[model samples]
Target: MQGKAGNAYLINELVRLVYLTYHVQDAGYGDTDVVVYARAEAALERCLQRAEREQVWRLEPDDAPMFEAILRQAGRQPA
Candidate 1:
């Protein structure tokens, strides 16, 4: 995992999980399944943290906006 392919894979994984979280909330399961929602949120947080720690955005300027958008969705300030 180095270079554009790695960046793309990480971004895709983040996007997939974010959409899954959104789907859970949109389906009203977030209210009924606290544990599930919490787990999803936790996973997203961990992914976001990893992206930030790796400086993924900075590594690939072309992918920066996408990473920033994901960060914002996770209520994190993009670095």
Candidate 2:
């Protein structure tokens, strides 16, 4: 039960990460305020780190390039 709950939490984090990435990308491209963009970027970075720490899933090959691009744009190294 505990393991299942942990898995569920990780899954939620993954979903959050996906949404954060999209928000960050949109904020970056749009005329959004810098503070808003920075906040979204920071959230995305935190999510990325959390997902990497879980080590339960890897980005698909098709997704890797875009993910890396986002990290680079955020001035972070792809982990």
Candidate 3:
């Protein structure tokens, strides 16, 4: 969450759901930490605005575990 840029988006579901992704500079000095937020890209703009007002903007709680699991399987993790 430090020295990073955060991003968010929505997925067209039964009801639109917002999600967030972030990336921070790699502590060990890589090309820069990068978070590829494919699932949430479509809703990014709105999600960011909401996060600014609410102080929290992340995938809905019920959806998070599954999202993270997918990321892990893909060899990625939230930054």
Point out where model 3 deviates above 4 Å. 1-38, 42-47, 76-79
lDDT of 1 by residue, 1-79 (tens): 2343456566467657556555655665433334444554464455456677875521334444444444354452221
lDDT of 3 by residue, 1-78 (tens): 111233343223312321222332132322312433344343344445657887555444444444444344334433
After superposition on all CA atoms, what RMSD does each candidate show versus the true structure?
A: 11.2, 11.0, 11.8
lDDT for model 2, on a 0 to 1 scale?
A: 0.46
Q: After superposition, how far is residue 26 of candidate 1 from its true place, in Å?
A: 7.7
Candidate ranking under TM-score, highest first, comes to: 1, 2, 3
Each candidate structure's TM-score, on Cα atoms with residue i matched to residue i, is 0.34, 0.33, 0.29
Higher-TM-score candidate of 1 and 2: 1
How does residue 59 of candidate 2 score in lDDT? 35
**If both were scored by TM-score, which would come out higher, candidate 2 or candidate 3?**
2
How big is the positional error of residue 10 in model 2, measured in Å on the Cα after superposition?
0.6
Q: List where candidate 1 sits over 4 angstroms from the true fold.
A: 1-32, 55-79
